[model samples]
Target: MSTWLFDLGNTRLKCAPLRDDGSIGEVVAIAHDDAGAWLDALPTGEVACIASVASDARRVELLDALCARFARLHRVRTEAALGPLRIAYAESAHLGVDRFLAMLGLCGAHAALVVGVGTALTVDLLDAAGRHRGGRIAPSPQLMREVLHARAAQLPAAGGEYAEFADDTDHALASGCEGAALALVERSLCAAHDLLGETPSLHLHGGGAETLRARLPAHAWTPEAVLLGLARWHVLRIA
Candidate 1:
């Protein structure tokens, strides 16, 4: 029997098969509005474990579709504590499942500052002991551009190269927005170091991660981190 992992985010649905050795296999990303178009191509497996941060209606639609394929479905939620991992939120439900799982993916011996850049920029901190140390949320660079273009007709929503000093408006928008995200992450890292008395490693993921990876210091980049976490969660559950 095969197991599949699905990470349903604000704009996209990413799925991957849980490999025999328990690693994530090739991932397939599909937009929310194009779900039906990819249904036939989605792998049919014995179990489908999903972690969703989409709207209620969108989640229902995806679940309804999955019901036709997978015989058993597991909806993963953020728990106050799962195994050694402990969430800092007084109400664990307030933490986004995507962020919870992203941190879960990197749960290990070393402390880490996990950053997710997608529709939103999310930064989370985890100690060596798997304790959540809270996090911050802000608009991702792309989102910042979109919002700016929405409010100001003259500003273009996309297509620009990031630079320290951009001579053009497009590049300036890109530089400013992405620079803001980088600064936030760096500030968080500094704070984490002061609080923990040791600098934590940095981990980056999500669609927008590539945009900022080249600009940041040494870090681990795992695009399918959430899926990896889902796979780990499944294993822990079955074990």
Candidate 2:
């Protein structure tokens, strides 16, 4: 039976088929604003598994649409422990499912830092034994720009390039916001290294992660971390 995995974030909704080998097929990303109309075109599937960090109303809308196309719909939630990974949150439900899934998807036999840059910048660290070491959340560079534009009508919402010394307002905004995010990632990596007594692998994901690729050359990029986690969740559920 064909299984579809959906990862609904604050800004985008990514969907793909889960292969027999547990790998994901081609991922299709749609803006949240266009998700409802796009869902109408989704192929029928035997099962639909989702990991959503969107608002409750948005989740309801997507769930309703998925319920229409699939006989079984599984909405994955944050868990205290899933297989090897043990969540640090005393209240697991308070942890974002997306973050939990990302860690589950990327955690390996070594310490690793998973940084997701989307509507929000999320950083989570997992040790070699799959123990959650806690995480942090901050406004993404794009969100920073939006917030700036909202507060200061004169500042443009978009259009900028990162630079050490920005010559224009646009570049300044871009550099500042991007630099802020990069700084956080760098700081986290340093702290993770100190805490683990060894350098932890850095994993980057989400829509905004690409912007940091040039700056974070050493970090491994895993765009489908959340969806991959959902696939893993499905495997664990059935096993």
RMSD to true structure for each model, in Å: 1.3, 1.3
Q: Which stretches of candidate 1 lie over 4 Å from their true place?
A: none
- The C-alpha lDDT values of all candidates are 0.90, 0.90
lDDT accuracy of residue 80 in candidate 2:
98
Q: How well does model 1 score by local distance difference test? A: 0.90
lDDT per residue, candidate 1, 46-154, as tens digits? Answer: 8999999989987888788888889999999998888668989999999999998898888899999999999999999999999999999999999999999999989
Sliding window of 10 residues with minimal summed lDDT for model 2:
34-43
Prediction 1 TM-score vs. true: 0.96
Off by over 4 Å in 2: none
